[model samples]
Structure formats: structure tokens, C-alpha cells
Target: MTPDHPKSRRSFSDFLLHLHPRTIPEENLRLTLSWGLGGMAVMLVCLLFLTGILLLLTYQPSTGSAYASIVTLTREVRFGLWIRNIHHWSANLLVVIAMLHLLRIVLTGAFGQGRRLNWIIGLFLLFLLLSANFTGYLLPWDQLAYWAVTICTSMLGYIPVGGLWLQELFRGGAEIGPATLSNFCVLHVAFIPATLFVLLLWHFWLVRRAGGLVQVEHDNPDDVPVQRVPTVPNLIVREAAVGLVLVAFILILAIVWDAPLMEQANPGMSPNPAKAPWYFLGFQELLLHLHPVFASFLWPLLGVAALLWVPFWQDSALPTGVWFGSNSGRRLVIWTATVGALTTLAIILADNLLLQSNAAVAVDTLVTRGLLPTALLIALLVGFYFLLVKGLKYTRAEAVMAGIVLVLVALAVCTIIGVWFRGAEMHLVWL
Candidate 1:
């Protein structure tokens, strides 16, 4: 037998304390909080990976074989159906958790101070996560996936100069074909994951270095106290618990129902009441009410520009972590509301535009319309910006009023885009 060493007798607790240089407190709330979400994110990623690997064994990426392979996985392979369900749900869950995490940071004002870079990276991660889901959605080669991509890629047409070329790059052709499927598959499987993994590492590293936001800090420096606990165990525990609960729920769902597989995708057949994915449904609903050019292109572009320019709009008025003393809090709330409203309006426009027009019901002719609506949209954006950024006085009430107006404007724009796309009569199924 090997001789007993003095260090070995000290136990795991002794080793942990030595490494951390901080005591593991009897009650470490910080650790508990951090671990909860972190663990959930990890578990969800693992679940997605495992399911995706299993799916790859059965999935065929070719245009001809793609739908058939999915059908086979659902009908023939044992537990294959369950695995797919888990995969689908996990993708959605990942998006949801990431959004919640972003919200948590914002609501707590944790993104102020030293964590701004992390906030930007977190936002980019959210965008990439959404992109991953979108790519994966198209792989099934179903009606819903088909139309969703059609409308989504169609929006790329709004880009200046090289918009058409960029759209072509996405489609790999004029329509959905082998190239589109293969490219999206590669992105969903490899590109997205690689980017996410790198950014996530940077994100966590920032979190570890800066410390998980001053979760319960007082605005007044006199009232603020130094945090004592190192976040590790308790945080992990909470994250694990949330993840376990989610996994249990997902497993039960998988056991009860198989993944949904629609028709074999006959390109010629038109489903009269075709729909986009539920999330995009709000946008599709926009098409029923708004003018295609204005609603679809100009309005949406302005909305994105507005989001990117928010920090700049505030200028140099407030310093980092300075939430109070000025009207910043109210202004921030207004800003968030404006963005949310803009998103909602975009949806409404999609739903209601072309409801009364002769060409409205058709799904193939959206692009043929003239430049008037588009020009009007551009003009409206310029007018709105002038009013919101220049004309409106910088006050709490002004901010509140601006937010309300933004919501209405955005909803209208999205509704218009939806109507324009749906009315084209192309038999698109974005669901």
C-alpha cells in the first residue's frame, strides 16, 4: 500500500478552500442563483447535442431524400421520435432561457457599469441562437419550413444595393433546393455551434471576472455593502434544479407524442390557409393590413436602426451604474417599450394589410408592386426619427409618449409586410 500523505487527509473541503482562497459559506445565495441558470443552459445544450447527433445518423440532407429520412426516423426507429421531440423543444428552450437571462440583467440594471461588453455579446448570442433555430427549422423540408424561409429570405430584399445577391446567397437559387438545404444544415450543425461555443466561453469568463451582477445593490453608495460569498456551489444547484425540471417535462412530452412531420412537400400544391411559425405568425398577420412596400421593407429597417442607436440617443448624459438622479430610468423604460411596440406593429401590419385588396389573397406577386409604398415607408421613418430624436423634448413624459407611439408604428409596419408576402399567393408556408 502507498504511504498516506498529510494533504490527502485534509479532505475535499480543504482542497477547495485552498484553490478558491475564499471560504464556502454555510449560506451562499449568490452561488445558488448563478448555478441555477448556468446549469440549465449547459444541460439544454447537452440535450440538443445528443439528440442532434442521433438525428444525424438518420437525417439525409439532399432535397429528394430529406423529408423521407425524417419520416423514417419518426416511423421506423425506436425512440427516434422521442429524440427528435427533445431536440425541437430544447432549441426553443435555449432561446427562451437566453432571452430571460438578458431580461434579468436589464431589469436588475446589471448591464450598467463594467458589464456592458458582456451585454452586447449576450445580445449577439441571442441573435445567433435564433439563427440556429431558423436553420434547423428549414431542414425538415415541410410546408411550414418552406414558407417561413421564403418570407424571411424575401425580407433580405430590403437591403441596399447587393440585397438581391445576398438573398440569392441565402437561397442558393431562386427557390428552395438542394443547395439551400445543405447550406442551412451545415450552419445549424457546425457553424452556429462553433460561434456559440466561443462567445459563450467569453461570456462566462466576463461573468466570472466581473462577478455575477450586483444582484441586490442599492443606488446609494452609502447603503451598498460588499458581497461576501464566492458564486459556485449554490449557483450550480439552482441552475441544476431548473434544468432537471425542464428535462423531466421534456422527457414526459417526448414519451407522449412523436415529433410532427407534415406532408411530403409537393411544391405545386397550395394550402389555402397557409401559416408561418407561431412566433412569425404575429408578423404574418401584418400582411392583412398594411401596404407591402412601406410595411415590409422601410418600416422594419427603421426599427432595427432605432434599436442599434438607442445607447447613442441617450448621449453622454449618464455615467455607468448611474440609474437615478436623472430621468434615465424613465427614459430607458420608454426606450424598451418603443422597441417592443415597433416589433408588435410589424406583426400587425403583416396580419391585416391587403385584407381588402383584389390582389391581397394571392401569395406570389408581392415583389411586383411599385415603389410608392416603399417610398412612403422610408419617409415615415425619417419623419418619426426627427420627431422622436430631435423634436420631442427630453423628458419623462415625452419618453413615455414616444414609446407608446413606437409600438403602434412597428405593429403597423409588420402587419403590412405579412399581408404583402401572404397576398402574393406563392403558396408559402412559413410555419
Candidate 2:
């Protein structure tokens, strides 16, 4: 048969459909459900891969030549700056999309039942995405990259037992140098990308196996059967449209705003208020108010542990596929978010005031600065849980959700402050 024949077209369509289910629930097609964040992530990853290959053609991943090579590429090579900008912006956008996808899964109770493993896989993918971005950040070999990475690696040293070892492992020495550049280049271009690709495939397969996107349940037996649509034309077309829009958006952004590149890496000089990447700025903000061990190691570890525990703690009675699990869950989120933001801002302001006054000297020790703050956070969370369960009559699942939302709100507030408000000497300065 000729390429344009019906038989040929049908066979080609079948080939495309093989990657997806022949029929998917109509609910899965709703953009409002998943917000197409997962599809956007996949599209961003594809963009990153394409732009990264273009970049690798000229990028010199070495302490001696990296910055000069990037400058030459940006100024001399055809479309080199645009390609680099796309890659840079796409990588950052992937981080945000991955996080939002994860949050969607949690809030909608998509991790319930057999999907727990997929949830864990999603978490790992997020971690790998962050790793990819972090390693790539050092590839530019500019002063901004150098000191930002130095600050982040230094945080790793705050871990109790293997902290210093881990820091040295990544830094390739006691500090960021030639060896560190080489190590990051390899991980960024080869190891991390390869691992992330494999995990992404596994994540997709698991989601398909779990029966597509989760859907709202029907309690009445007489309810009409749920609608279904073919994946080849329906789902694929929607995805393609979304992908094109995302590409257009990123391309416009790439043209409008060039990716930042500062002076060459200088060991002799450090930028005052040298900060970590925007993603890690939340932790950097935390470090200002708490002990390094608590801010850098313990609290982060606990947060991850809490996320991992979410699936197991999920209440079976809570309906899956509904936003916030129920109306109670929605109310809990609203209340938690308001209280959490106010409390976080209050604490930051109070702490800053104390630091500016003689009172800070009295609270400078580990107990007052570290353990006390840690205990207070725990107390607040526990207290909030009880209040929700007892006073508000929320279910256990809703209470867990409240805690998660509160923590997210607090982190967001901290990140915003770190990125925009903090100025010289890490002092809070309204911009």
C-alpha cells in the first residue's frame, strides 16, 4: 500500500497507539484535572535534550576554558545564545512543572491503592531533575555559578555523620576547583540524564498500568457508565497542542530574556550575600533563622520522610481523584495556608528583630537557635493536627493534608523572601 492509503494510515495510527492505551477514561482528557503539567514536563525534558545536544557541541566543561567558551558561543556561533537560553529556561521550568505535578498527585489522592510505587518514582524523578539542574548550574564556570554552588555544597557539610564526605565527593576536593568542574560536567551530561530518562520511562509505564488518571467515584449503582475515548487521535492531539503551546511560550521567553552569565569564576572574591540556586534559597533562608544542621540536614530529611510516608498514611475512606480529598480537606488547606503564612512571616520578622538587638546574643547558642525552633515547629504542626481532627471534625487524611499544605506554604514564603527580599549580608531588604 502507498503511504497515503487508508491501510497505511491505519497501521501508522496503531503504531502510535501502541505506546498508550487504546481507550482512556474521558476524565483523563480534562485539562483541569491534571492541568497537563505532566505533559508540559515531558515536553520540557524533550526541549532540554534537544538544546543540550546543541550546547554540548561548543560547551567547554573545564575551569580554564568553560567561561570563555560560553562567551564565544554566545557572541559568535549562530543561534548559540538562543539555544543556551532555551536549555537554561527549560531546565528551570522542568523543576517547577515536576513539583506542581507531584503536588497535583498528592492533593488529588492519586497515590492511593496500587499507585503508591508510582508516587515514590515521581518523587525520585523530582530529585533527579533537581540534581540535573544543580550539576548543570556549575557548567557555566562563572562567578555566579561558582559561589552559588559553593554555598550549596557547604550546606551538605552540615549533615551529622557523612556530611563532609558527601560534600568532598561532589566538590572533588576541599573546594570547588578544576576537579569539581569535571565531576559536575560528567554527571550533568551523562550520568544524571541517563538515569532520569530510565526513571521517566518507568514512571510512565507505571502510570499506564495503574489505569490512566484517577477519576471521581460514583456511589450510586444506577449512574451512567463513564465516558471513554481513543488515545490515538483524541489524547495524542490534545498533547500535541499543549506541547506546541509550551514550545512557543519557552521560545518567546528565550528571545525576551537571555540566561544570566556573570564574570569568570574567582576563588579570591565572593559575591556578598552569595546564595544558592533559587530552588535551594528556601533552605538558605532557613539557615539564617536556625542552626545549619537543622536547616540544611535534619529538616530537609524530615520533609522528604514525611512525603514518603504520605501514601502509607492515606485514609482508605477518603475518596480518591477528588481535589483535597473532600470539602473538609479544602477548608483545612485554606485555614492551614492562612495560619502558616502569617506564622512564618511573624517568626522571620521576630528573628530578624532579635538579631538586630541585644536579645540575639542570648539566643545564639545551639539550644536556643536550633533545638528550640525545631521543637516549636513540631509543636505547632502537632497542635494543628489535633485542632483539625478534634475541633474541626476533619478526618485523619485531611489533617495530614493540612500539615503538608502548611509546610509547603511556609517553604514558599521563605523562598520568596530569599529570592527577592534578602539583600547584602543576607539581610532582609525589600526590593
Candidate 3:
């Protein structure tokens, strides 16, 4: 109202410019530094740096001598066991902790409003994490590592047009051989790491520009004002705490239990029941139960398409002032979850029963060679989609549905682990 006031004029300009002022609360910022993802990310990056340095000293990424070099490192090099342990554990921890950090962001609802791009970056980070882990898995040169890569590459056959080519690229040949191992090792230790480093730097730069986590929705200034702390000091403390704990634990595990090394890979011998890594075994399971069109192509395609459409599920055809939950939006989420869980349970039970039945017992000549298992896998994935779409009409809570679906998926995973453990005990190699 004061037309001539300097402060009033500046305030008007600020409003017109769409600017908002925020005072940095030192205590709040300091606390953010203490526990936020910034600390976690720094710890993971540090682990990568230290362990990667150690790995570079001994790792020989070549087709002819890579496995032999690893053997030499374990048997001959000084403290080489520790170095390998650090590299293995650091890679595993990086992925696990990064997921945790992403979950923290999601639970805190920090992905809403202007932070959508941050969420996208986090998703890309997850993809990179998986790529990094997958590449690393191929480096150990054990049976588990070798055939696991083979099984995974084979899954690309489900891709529509270029699946075969993609699979070849992964193998670096028409089949899994020394070239595949060497190529993967290079990507793991060299190329992927370089890209990861660049992306990580970009991610942090974005974080800095965006500022840290938004205040929790439940926080009330009248109740207790939040605190803000500077990034440097708090990072030094909290990251040291988490990083040291993780590193020490891995060191102890490595010292006590050497990583499993199955017999040197032999492409000529197909073991009784070869399996991929656990993360991919579920997918491998899918290949058992359906036709290629249903198993490899349509199912994965649809699953991903469903995930992409999630944000739009409750929205109308055109943007409107109506709220997302004005109708049965939340109810729909619950029904989706309920249906997914039920279908997964059915498919898993069916698979286990079939595997243990007389049909599996007989193990006819051709079927035993691996076609039966592959067909069973295709069936499983198709069955999963069939059951998932069954409960679209229910009314329930989103959280409840998500929890139920999670439980079902976990149960199926546990079942697979049980099967693997039994096979492992029998010394029956399957991969």
C-alpha cells in the first residue's frame, strides 16, 4: 500500500518474477547433512573409488588370461584377497544403498511438484546401478557368473526386433565364450564406471541446485521448527559412520568366507539344472510357462507399459480441475495390487507342483535337454499377467494393495531360493 517504499517496490518485483525467499536455518541444514541421501551417496562413491583402485591393480581384462589372473591374485598376490573382497562387497553395497536412498526420496514424497526431474534422474540411477552390477557379475569367471550372463542375455530374445542382436552384443559372440567374459569385464571395470562417474557428478550437481529434501509434511513450525546444517561437516561425520560400518562388515565376511567359485566354466557340459542369478531367475521362471509371444515379448512389454501408465491411471483423458482421488483412484490401486499378488501365488504354486510331479520325474530325453524348463518359464510369466488383471474391480487402500503384492512377490522369490538351495545341496549343477 506504501507506493514510494523501496521494500514494497522490491516485493512487487519479486512477486512478478516468481521468486520466493528462504532463510537457511543452520541447524536444519546441518541435520539434513547428517542423515539425508547426500551422505549415503558420498559413502557409496567413496567405496567405489577405494575398491576400484584396488581392483585395477590386479584385474586383467582379457579373454585368454582373465580367470587365470584372478586365480593368481587369490593365490599369489599380497592382500589380493582383501582387494577382491572389497570390490565385490562395495559393488553389492552400492546398489543396495542406492535403492534405499531412492526409497527414502519416494517415502518422503520429494518427487512431487518441481522435483519430477529428480525422480527421473533417480530412476536412471537405478538402471545404471543394475547395469553396473550385471557387468560386475560377469567378472568373477566362475560357473555361476558365466552361465548367469548367458541366461540373462538369452532373455533379450523376448525383445521384438533387435533382441538377438542385443544378446550377441552382450556375449560379444554368437555364444557365451571367453570373449563374452573379457568384454563384460572391460565394461564393468572401465567403460561403465566412467559413465557412472559422469552421471553421478551430474546427479549431485542437480541435488545441489535443487537443495535437499523438502520439510516433512507433518512437521509444524509451531510444534518444533526444523533445523538446517551445512553439507561439509555433517557429511564427514555421518558418511564416515555408515561407510566404515559397511566396509568393516564386508571385510569380516570376506575374510571368513571366500566367495564361491564353481568349477571352471565348460560350455560343453550343460549341468542338470542351470540357473541365472536370483534377480533374473524370476524372469527365467516366466520363460517356462508361455509361448514366446506371450512370455518373452508381450509380458515384459505389457509390464513395463503398465508401470509407465501408473501416473496417468487415475487422470482423465484431458487435464481438468478435478482431483486425482475424486473418484475411485485409490481404490483402483488397491485392486491392482490385490490381483497381482493372487496371480503370482497361483503361478508359483503351479510351477512347483509341476516340477515335482511325475512329469518332471520321468524327464524324457528331449525335455531333459532343457526345452521343457524353457517352456515352463514361458508359462509362468503369461500366467502371472493373466492373474494380475483379474481383480480390477476391488475397492481398497493403495498401501494395502502394494503391501499385499510385495508379499506375494517375496513369497515367490523365497520359493525359488528354496529350490536353488536343494539343488545346491545335491551338487546338481543347473546352468
Q: Which candidate's lDDT is highest?
A: 2
Candidate 1, position 230, lDDT: 48
Backbone clash count, each prediction separately: 61, 0, 29
Give the per-residue Cα lDDT of candidate 1 at 128: 85
Better of 1 and 3 by lDDT: 1
Q: What C-alpha RMSD separates each model from the true structure?
A: 6.7, 1.8, 10.2
Better of 2 and 3 by lDDT: 2
For residues 66-170, write the lDDT of model 2, one tens digit per residue.
Answer: 999999999999999999999999999998898889778878878878888998899899999999999999999999999999999999998999999999999
Q: In candidate 1, residue 213 scores what lDDT?
A: 42
Off by over 4 Å in 1: 1-42, 219-224, 291-297, 312-431
State every prediction's TM-score relative to the real structure: 0.70, 0.96, 0.69
For model 1, how does the per-residue alpha-carbon lDDT over 1-431 read when each residue is reduced to its tens digit?
23366556445445544333342333335443333555567678889888999999999998888888998898899988888999998887787677556444533445545666676787678778888888998898987677677777776765557878988898898777788899899999999989988998788667656654435445785775554554345434455567789799889987886666777665676455565554454445534333444445555556555444443343322333223214754565567566756656554445334433455354333443325444655576556546655676454323423443454445544543444544445232343
- Give candidate 3's error at residue 130 in angstroms: 1.6
- Cα miss at 89, model 2 (Å)? 0.8
Residue 420 of model 3, lDDT score? 68
lDDT of each: 0.62, 0.88, 0.58
What TM-score should be assigned to candidate 2?
0.96
Q: Per-residue error at 290 for model 2, in Å?
A: 0.6
